[model samples]
Target: MSALPCPCGSGSPYRDCCGPLLRGESPAATAEALMRSRYTAYVRRDEAYLLRTWEASHRPAALEMDDDAWLGLEVLATEAGGADDREGIVVFVARYQDQAGVVAEVRERSRFARQAGEWLYVDGETHP
Candidate 1:
């Protein structure tokens, strides 16, 4: 059977894109890559991967996956989230439909940090 497309909308197979990362088979090469994987985790309701990739300082005690159905992701811009950078920023808009059938978009400027050769999500500032 063929693998489904990655929920991150990377135009690549899930196995080729976020599957390995979600499975802990490989680490994300860049901050944006980490961000993409996190979005995929949300779609799959993989709470473990979400917590694992979150920075320790900012990681919550636990996560509760919501009922919203993730529709798509749009990466608007990125700054310095490269393999050689310690810190980077990614601005994106994620769309979803809630249980009540309300469609909405979440726009955020997320910050990521690379530590011990691994990229971790730090935090994000949501835009209105």
Candidate 2:
């Protein structure tokens, strides 16, 4: 079977895109890349991957995956968060449908920090 397309909308096969990151085979090279992988983790309900990439200061003790059907991801903007930058910001919108059949979009400006050459999600500010 043809490899499924990456849920991160990277136009690449899952194995070539976020799959490696989720499987702990590779580390994201940039903050934007890490953000995309995190979204993919949500889509697949890979809570372990999500927690592993989250900054320890903000990392939750556990993740509770909701019954949201992830539809798509659209990266709107990015600041810094490059391979060499220690800090960065990414603004994006994620669309999903809840179990109750209500569709909604989450617009967020996320913060990321690179430490020991690994990008970690710090937090985000959601928009209404």
Candidate 3:
């Protein structure tokens, strides 16, 4: 079986791929970068970064993470692109261990919004 690219593939090395974005680089010219950074946020458990990117209406008091768990991301797809008004649609599955040391998966279709001149994570649909 062929191994899948990093959860936020974007066809680039995980570090160079999402590093720039998480470091404040704009989404990839092709919309892939946005998807990747979102993954990186999960990997690093950057609650502040995640909150800053989330739209206010949906923003939570704080983002949560399993302190003892490590997370990885895989970006399945991204669609709806544009330079004026970009929309990043990413399918990702996050893998991590729970308090009991059981491995688990979280699948979601995330929606992103770029308001004014910044790309922000909006919300998503969870499946499984």
Candidate 4:
């Protein structure tokens, strides 16, 4: 089956953008790519992919994602996370609609690391 548009707002279909990465068809080449794929994972409720992309040091033992309905993702900026870089940062805003039908958005600057030729999310500091 064909996938939908990537929730990461790449304007490309999920199959072409983050789908392959999420399905383990390929590894994210950059920090921003990892961040985008993670957001898409949240939308798809693929907790396994979420945990896999997370750094072990910060990865939680378990995740509970049954709450809010994720609406969309908007990547704000990036620094240093490239194919050759060992570390990188991505700034983004993710919008969600709660069960109450109230909409909210969260802004974060996330850090990532490249280990064993794979980029993984380390941590993030939310913006007010």
What TM-score would each prediction reach against the true structure?
Answer: 0.97, 0.97, 0.73, 0.95
Best-to-worst order by lDDT is 2, 1, 4, 3
Alpha carbon lDDT of each predicted model = 0.95, 0.96, 0.66, 0.92
lDDT per residue (tens digit) for residues 8-97 in model 4: 888888889999999999999899999999998888899999999999999998899877889888888999999999999999999999
Compared with the true structure, the alpha-carbon lDDT of candidate 3 equals 0.66
RMSD of each: 1.0, 1.1, 4.8, 1.1
Off by over 4 Å in 1: none
Q: Pairing residues by index, what is the TM-score of model 3?
A: 0.73
Error of 3 at 72 (Å): 3.2
lDDT digits (tens) for residues 1-128 of candidate 2? 12989999999999899988998999999999999999999999999999999999999999999989999999999999999899999999999999999999999999999999999999999998
Error of 3 at 24 (Å): 2.8
State which candidate, 2 or 3, has the greater TM-score.
2
User: What residue runs in model 4 are displaced by over 4 Å at the alpha carbon?
Assistant: 1-3
Off by over 4 Å in 3: 1-15, 25-31, 82-85
lDDT of 1 by residue, 1-128 (tens): 12889999899999899999999999999999999999999999999999999999999999999989999999999999899999999999999999999999999999999999999999999998
